[model samples]
Target: MVEALNKFQLIGQEQTRRYWETLIGSGRFGHAHILSGHSGVGKDALAFFIAAALNCKADTKKPCGNCISCRQFLNLENQALQLIFALPRRSANQTDPFTGIKEKEMILINEELAKKAAWPYYHLQIDAANDIRIAGIRKLRKDIYLAIDPGTTRVIIILRAHKMNMEAANALLKILEEPPAGTIFLLTTEYADRLPDTIRSRCALHHVPDLNWKLIREDLLQKKGVDPVQAEICARMSMGDLAAAHGYAEQDNTFWLDRIRATLNTLAKEDFVSVHKQVLLLADKEEQTDDSRQQFLSLLILFFRDVALKVKMGETVLWATQSQQMNKLFPNCDSQGAIKAIERTKNALERKVHLQLALTALFFELRKHLRR
Candidate 1:
């Protein structure tokens, strides 16, 4: 039997891996753990690995990758895995957690989950999902107490746990305080501080630090078959987010940068006609997926950051070619206001606001900020 479990390409965090392996091997790990970290740092991946280890059927070693249980976990077909995350709001009188979810929304959620299962580092997204509602937690409370096989551990993972509203958070707190036997809770969030203090106090916090830039670049080049030049650019632009770096590797960075340049000029000139056209293009389902939309927004933010760098340090990093035009347009760019507006738009998008409306508002906000 293999003594060491396969990491499944879970990249770095040697210390975190060693700690969990030892604890899980000893069969004395805590009932609850919160994997807190910035985006794309493998918090969810680590949590999934730990959950797999806990439920692995190998007698002498945990997560013996060859076992039936491990195979199921890798395929995300493991019966023991329970995933919870933010979802769109249900009807006011709807008590069933999933009954109110529209068919398309459900399909999107499942697709994102499958992607995450295939690549542990992949970030999951559902366009309409915003917050974890109480009904889901209520259902979980019932499900946790159900009977399971002997020696099996039920793993419940709540991704983006900080999105839990007050009602759902309180409901989850009750479960953590007196968790059911043979069950484990793994909560992950980029914004752990946003979680209630009481909930934070109950779980063991494990901070997953950002991945190294060189390591990300290497992974893209070796495993992802990304071009060396593009890989380096994505790695640097990702800001230590490996998942974002992977996504960037697949995207046409130049195209997005060009779009941003054109959009910025329109916003600066207060051209509502062109601004509306840009919004329609951005919101086009035929042209942009939810992931692409998010990528576009991120690129826009980076573009503004480049402007700030150019204004403050006399040099722009990401798109030096565009720096000349941007300088000519806004000699004194108000990057602070522009960034704040982008953030507000990002928040609005997460809340399932209409894409056209959100992008339109963002353009107006940008016009206000960039006019100076």
Candidate 2:
């Protein structure tokens, strides 16, 4: 059974793989397991792999992904595997209200699965009420009580488990307390603290760590077919989050990079013209989305981090292509100041403060750091 974990293909988190393999193999596997970690880490992926391995009929090569059970799980088409995720309840414009809401949710969930099938690093995005409602859980409770095909292990994965509504969480807790034999509950969450203590206590907990930069860099190049330099950049920017690195590679990231470069320059020089230009550009289509804005801010943080590296390790910066700027401003740039600036900007955004004003303040503060 331990050998099975070594055979698993999950990148990074080797410890977690071994632990689960041992638990399942020893017949000590808990009915519920909680995979807790940062968003975009491989928590969901690891959970799915464990579920697949448990359900597969392979004798030694547990998830010999070639088997029917393994293949179905890989495709997320396994009848025994149930995937649950948050979907907004209903839209204001939903006409039928009852059927329309359920139909819409199903459509969105199918779309999410399609994305996952095509891109292994996809994160489900539900536009409406992003919480698992009691209705879904009640149905699950009923379904789990029903019959199971003999050798088929029923594995239910509740993704973004932290988003479960209170009622849903309570309902799930009851099931966890007395889970049926051959049924497994795998819950993945970025915020395990939000789960009730009773729910957390019922499940075996696995902490998923971020993949290291080297692994991410190699994965991006080998698995994702990204070019060397761009792959390195994406991996560095992603900071061990493969999902984000893949997204950075898939999109024409230059759109954001160019703006980010411009903004960085404005911050360095306290240039009124460039700052004003950025405000208008960012307010428009390209930089408007929260994802875009967060990416932009993350890039800014990385840029300063590179500046710090440039000062500490001459001729070496993460974004080697941006060395000219790093040399120009960050020769004496305070790393603490850069960190402070990043914290301020991140806090402002998290608090839902005015984006433009927050960014304006960030630039002003950054100017002091780079100038100092």
Candidate 3:
């Protein structure tokens, strides 16, 4: 069995790719492995590629994605592939993993899976589904030992593995200690240290590095068809996280950017009424207020960053297209104070403080600093 980790069309974690290629090429396809990294760093993608490669039947470059097994993996229809992740808490009387799941919850889960199938880098999320329950592991324990195609390699992927509750973690540990024949476990998590020492000791752990900003930018422009300007801006702001850059690209940033520019002028004049109204509008969305506010703050940070860059370096800025308006608003921009204020508000927001209050205080601070 040549269980080599062939290239998976990944963006750029060269070190991880080399590590896996060497391990798999040695024909020591271990029982369990963990690919750990921060969110948006392509751990899920690498795991999926490994699963596909394991079952691929190609003679030469494994995961010759056209092979039947690889196609099944790509379509997420492979019977030999078992995917596990966090789910809503099961009822006390429920024994089956799917017994107590609501229809809406199931629909949402399927939708997220579909998105993942389309793009392996897509982050899977379910509202209020915070932890993996023990029932799911018990179910997996039963299924993995059952009958399967003779040539098929059973690959079990547990995404966000750190989200496993204590009971689920213990149950999974037992299987990891003595996994069934022809079965392999692949776990991906942002916080690998959260796993018990015993569990970590049983698996080969590999760290997946964050994507380069240039790789992200090119992917946005070429793969996602994002406009060059928007792609450049989002990639520059993503801090080496591809998923965040993709999300930023999808958002209608112009709406928030216009408001930010207006808010700056309002603050400079100390127009409390207009400032209060603008903040209220941003904080009014009952469900999306957190994400909306964060997006607005991120854009504001970029705005001030451009100010500093223009003032000091005389270099090209992200919003150079809007130079006329920026120059009018920030004639003698001093962004340090304003940036500090924004960072403070951002920290408060993360702590679940009152959004409106935080925004109002931020505006007052910005007024003092940016007023010419």
Candidate 4:
């Protein structure tokens, strides 16, 4: 191995690794740091690695995974490592005519923490209790001021830090303002913009980049043992999400591809009626998974993107990779219209626009460009 195992379970995040090595190698590191990036980009893994490295007893290179300190950190058994994540007040399915399930909520959070200890990248994707409450923040505040672990540095890592409610954020800001010596606060968030400027400004922020296609390809082939052709397709579609790529490798996207091809047919004929029907189908699908609408929209965008690229760059189509004549099917398509639709739909969906209205407007715009 060219690189010594630095204790981070998550790989491919070069920026975080380089930053940790430099910080620890020079013996100069900050008290607080923010690891910001998209979800599944391994922000949590990076945090655990940094914490372990800081306390490792390796005489030369730090985070020697074999060292006793590194072992404790690896198992997440180190007392100096304080892990905090979002815990909601109740379950998302709690549609009961009552509020407050604090006990149940805490139990679920404990389960999530255990899962995280086993797999640091484990995201408590349970949307219900997804916030770092004021209570957790207060506990952190109390714990930090207490006596330090004699031999190691204290590492407080707050996963999904963006989930902190307003009160919790304020409480955290105070701790970040006047951080104690020998204590490092590692905060990880998928949405840094959700955090207030005051809290953001205090920490040394590092934006972890999305995983590249090359990295995903290597992982798919070597780790998952996926066939080369399918691996290429999965790598293409994952859009820098490791988890999504893994899912694509393991599961068939036949339904997803069929939907994309069906939508492409509507666009090919400039059939406004059919386009509206597709919108209706998507709107209906959203009921099962609230974000299914966006996922479908993402599929559409990819389709349009592939078509546009085929027209412009002569690249093989993703949906019809084997068909050399596929580009001809979209001769009347306005490349500009395709571009506009991708951007407009993406922006509208992100802003939480109503699906029917957004898709209706987009289809009309696309029809106008494609002609009569």
Candidate 5:
């Protein structure tokens, strides 16, 4: 995978390509590079590509996949290449089932859970500044200084460089300022704001944009065997986030739609008790996962948004797919009331209110817009 970077489809960043090519052309491939973008973008993919290009054995522009160096890069067996991933430390109660009881017990007994779990873990937690203790910084410094394997350039890929505390950042800054020979550092971050100015200044930056919806939808259909209609719907909803689109297409969206339908039906029938019960069910189900809550809320928002869009455009309401059946259920709803209800729902979501509370409130509010 690393060897493939030089030739990988970088998707959207043409400018980034020129920047990297210029660096490579100048024999400065050993310099540190930073790839920053929003979550779900292909930053990590590009990092691997860059690493592969650096180590490519091709006699020409280097990452020739056919060369011996390319083979080593492909196998990820090259001693010169080191990949360190900094994942968040799991809560003490959460242990890999495969680990022995002793390991599990050790984690339970460990007293550092609170401190370790305070901040979301990034790709690299090396904080050379105020947040990183001197000991941790010293260890990283030593690791950075270790001699590279003979005849091979060392490449270190840091997955989330933003998680570093001040102490860790300072320690890293020192190395970046006076980088060792034969060393190339690759830092990938989703939240570039959290990174220190000094750290950002030391490395060349590359941006990876979200994948195009058209391409993402096609990929889903071709690679994942998703239905074309479903793929297009998911693609539009995901707004180019391929991972989210895939998840939406793979899951049973019908379940959520059914729940929304039930809620609307209960409200229409003036069954307040049933509406409360339905809200409870949704809240209970969503309590299991943040993803569930997010999906439910998103569906509800889109439902109302589409309804509002229809009313505003003065288009026939039949065009609103999700709300089409609601016409007979609430024949008295006025445009002003519908718009207000939509605005209220949007505000609740923006404020991060509890999903059930938001949904229940929206239901009652919608009653005002419905026929008596």
Candidate 6:
């Protein structure tokens, strides 16, 4: 087995670590644990680590990496550790042949399907919680009744547990209330408020706060080979989200910089046609998925927000990277107009308007603001 130290990275969660140790040491390890936090806070990583530690057969306080149990666990041969993920439902465009399988029957990660699932811009639909489906729940009931495997504990890690619908949630509640012996359920969610009170009550809650900027910067510098200045900048912009920081680090910022520059330049010149064209191009690129469209709209909002901040603060702009461009463009633009445009865009997103129409209308409004 690979070393436990090598498999997991636990940083800045000393209290949570103690809590887990106490639970395990006292032998009162609850059947259900809910790990809640903001997105990109490493909650999922923590959940998986806890699951591994519980199933490990190390003689020490923690899992020893060289044991037979650890070897099987690392190889994913420990059938006791199961993962139930929220999968997108089969739409007209995409379908999974094995959609009806029970949670207990699922053993292998379908790599091909996983790649398709990871396609950017796909939103989590309400119907993706197959593990919580009536059929799935019945199967889980049966599985729980079976005797525990010797030297192994059954564990189920459910990602985005809040996505489960009312029926699914109630089913899960039943399992939580009277979970079978030697079974552990680890639930992770970015939005815990969506979960029902009854369901939340059954689980031990652990809050995972966002990673500190210092840690984020260090990780970027040491692991990603990012220069100090760039790492610091991305870390600040990410607002404690390591995932977002990593994404920013990987992205080619130059394209976005040029896009924003072009937008400002055209608006300043009152070139309505060019403005419309650019917005349409952006909307077209985002047409593949609702999530992508939302993301693109969010980026535009941030760009305009930075512009507004630059105009208001003059030399005290927080986003220094865009300050020079702001200075060059602000004199010719209307601050109130920009603010109104932002409001309209946000309103459209909140209303769940179609992506193409919303963006087209947004740019049209922006053009009016530009001329004013």
- The best candidate by lDDT is 1
Residue-level lDDT of model 3, residues 291-343, one tens digit each, is 77777787788778776666332333345645445556767656778888898
lDDT (Cα, tens digit) per residue for candidate 4, span 234-306: 7767788776777767865446666766766676664668988877877674443545555556666666566
> Candidate 6, TM-score vs. the true structure?
0.62
Segments in model 3 whose C-alpha atoms lie over 4 Å from true places: 1-9, 89-95, 102-108, 125-128, 258-290, 303-317, 320-340, 350-372
Steric overlap count per candidate: 0, 2, 0, 1, 15, 0
lDDT of 2 by residue, 317-358 (tens): 345556456666567767568778877777778778877787
lDDT per residue as tens, model 6, 229-310: 5676566556677777777677534344456556656655656678677767666744434444444444555566556566
Model 1 / residue 7 / CA error / Å = 6.9
Q: What is the C-alpha lDDT of each candidate?
A: 0.80, 0.74, 0.78, 0.71, 0.60, 0.62
Q: Name the candidate that leads on TM-score.
A: 2
Question: How much is 88 displaced in model 6, in angstroms?
Answer: 8.5
lDDT of 5 by residue, 27-104 (tens): 846578788876655676566556766776665554565666655555555666655433233332222211233564
Candidate 1 global TM-score: 0.68
TM-score, candidate number 4: 0.75
In model 2, residue pairs whose N, Cα or C atoms come closer than 3 Å (at least 3 residues apart or on different chains), thus clashing, are 88-128, 88-129
Candidates by lDDT, descending order: 1, 3, 2, 4, 6, 5
Badly placed stretches (over 4 Å) of model 1 are 1-7, 59-61, 93-95, 254-372
Cα RMSD (Å) between model 2 and the true structure?
A: 5.0
